[model samples]
Target: MIRSHSKLATALMGGLAAGLLLTACGGSAEPSSTTAASSAASTAAEVATSAAAEPITLRFIWWGNDTRNALTQQVIDLYKTTHPNITIETETADFATYWQKLSTQVAGGDAPDIIQMDEKYLAEYASQGALLDLESIGLDTSDWAEGTVDAGRFDGTLYAATFGVNAPVFLANTSVFEKAGVEIPDDTTWTWESFAEMAKQIQAAGGGEYYGVENLIGVDGASKIWLRQQGAQQFTSDGIGFTAADIQPWFEYWKQLMDEGGTAPATATIENQTTAVDQAFLGTNRVAIGFQWSNQVNAVQNASGQDILILRPPTQTGNAADGHLWYKSSMYLSAGAKTKYPEAVKEFIEFLINDPDCGAILGTERGVPTNLKVREAVAPQLDAANTKVIEFMDSIADELGTGGSVPLPGGGQSETIQRRATDAVLLGDLDPATAAEQFVTELKAEMGLS
Candidate 1:
């Protein structure tokens, strides 16, 4: 939500490399007279020199692509202007590789001073003592988004800080609706049955393309929605939420849709050539509806040259609890448990979330700005697409169900249940009921739950 007139530059990748080299030489090498006095009371600051000195250097690292890396550097530069004595070292990479490097650093006692973490890994990292307790570092969470902060906590102690919220939204091509002679329904009250039925209707009234919607069994997000509808969580406090019986009904639901020709064939999901943003089948007029996060609607619409409207997921109850999408931190910033300058690292995180310039430069790249103050500051500068997302989320704020607990402690295999559902069905190893039962058992076992 923080919108800055100045664009953020992505220089952290290079800066981080330099920081690592300096770290190799050891932080104790020599304190430049410029290094400020450490006023931070945390243990990490205990080793510093006189309080009259300038702020010391704090090394931070995170995973992100070109845009994210650039914006992060811009924010850091802005922070440096005000707190001139403090220096921040940053690193970045794509999501998958980012974790690999972070895990290694954690094991080697050289983890970055600050890390950009994800919910899927939050519990695991926090449990392993790889991260610092955020409260110990002087972070104030009184103003961050509720869900964002909650996502970063482990065992009731806040360990990280978050910056935004994301929700699943249905991207629709209004032009396709007109051509197919179909009317968009009041999504608030529409049920999954209604959505499936409507897709059939659109296919019957076909104009150009496969049908009214294209969803895939292989899509993890979609599977999450179905899992929620069945009154199960993705992962439980102990581990997997449901047994194989629970998975069966959901698999059968999708299988029925696929069998009825209401969605694109399985081959399409596996073989489609499309960029993450373009969504080729939906953008090129081959499908009318696509499931994506609200943050992605703009890119999808831009590629298609169509009027895109975000709609609520279809659910049975008018009460709406059955179809709510919980908000999450776009990413979290946590300190390495082994860092030599924990206070500096904590200060760097504080500046990133609370500084006006940092928030503005961040804009919506992290999803909606998690800071209430930042959201207000950046609202005026938002583009139409971004503004729409803000307004939509505000409208549904009260309607969202409980954000729920953080994901369980399974590392790489946390999402396995969703992935294996179809395979279990296709291989004839078990029926839907049996598959669901086995899924629950495996998930619990992986989570270390009895």
Candidate 2:
């Protein structure tokens, strides 16, 4: 699910103000440089200037908070220092509004030259010819890990470059565990049943002060992992891969957790599920365990003021080998298909992916570096939290399954549907079996399969 904040509201109001200002000014006013050059010598200079290298202005757009924006701007500045003829203008919005604005801009033929993309929408845009083929543009991927380059492919063409790689992880607040006098379960050998039992124990020990884990029934990431564990893809080349039967058990599992007091109450879980990272159950020390992307470890630690430990999600059959974990592109960078300056955009993407200096500056904020060389070079410089994430990822490398399927055109709506269905189940409006059935039906309709 996309997290929201007051920043998005501020950005929306700013956009409105800019629109009103443009209306007041009656659009952009032109300068009369040509009319001022009356002398032959001045005309000659003007002609020469027109023939010389013109400055290339590229507009780039992304979704992030102030920290990411600052680091990205630094990288852009570094690039500009070397390529003085190129100029870059950046626009940013919170995750909740980024896609809405991007879709509107693209439809109006005002898309940015460079776009920060997510896996959920990459295929949706690429399949519609909105994104450029990176391979065709000659963006280098030779330094990237093997098969990592394929994360952004659609119909055998590379539409984007993997900017960073991550995987879903269970983030345990060690302090909370210690306070409850509960030992962290061995992730390598833990099954879903054992996981629930552990959570129940933690909650029992906390005396209402804390919960064992955040209620994750509505979390799309958890659903994906569950599907993978069942040897099912979330999306296939054909359509949605899992059936109602596949989904029923997942809902049942979480319902069981709620019944056993292993997680927060239904209403509280629904509220916390959508809360911002800094104020969520895990972030506020209201829960001992929670789920998040691996890249979020540092941020969660910073917010909670506690030592956070990353663990592999529980598997079926109590075996790590049965886990269907895989490395995913945390996000991607794609050039606009309609960009006027494709070559310059491609150059900038190349620098972002392969430059050691850029890697140092970014330092896993986006994710672990996609470029293997950069990953190796920046290892010693990472802080303790990031280092733990890196180590966890490396330890699980051999256990991962194949990469996940690309999300389909309407795939973005699946999370919302999941949330609604899960809410109905938790509120006693629908049983697990009926909720699962309704979920599949709505998801099919959303993906145009119904």
Q: Could you tell me the C-alpha RMSD of candidate 2 in Å?
A: 12.0
TM-score of each: 0.79, 0.87
TM-score of 1: 0.79
- Encode model 2's per-residue lDDT on 1-450: one tens digit a residue: 134566787789999999998898995554422211113322233333222457677778888765677788788767766776676777778777889989999999999999999988987899899999888888888989876798888888999899999989999999999999988889999999999999999999989999989888899888899999998878876678899899899999999899899999899999997777877899989899999999888878888999899999999899998888889899999998999998899899989999998998898889899999999999999878778888988999988987467778888788899988999988878999999999999999988996
What's the lDDT for all of these models?
A: 0.69, 0.86
**For candidate 2, which ten residues in a row score worst on lDDT?**
32-41
lDDT of 2: 0.86
Q: Of the candidates shown, which would achieve the greatest TM-score relative to the real structure?
A: 2
- Single out the weakest 10-residue window by summed lDDT for candidate 1: 33-42
Error of 2 at 218 (Å): 0.8
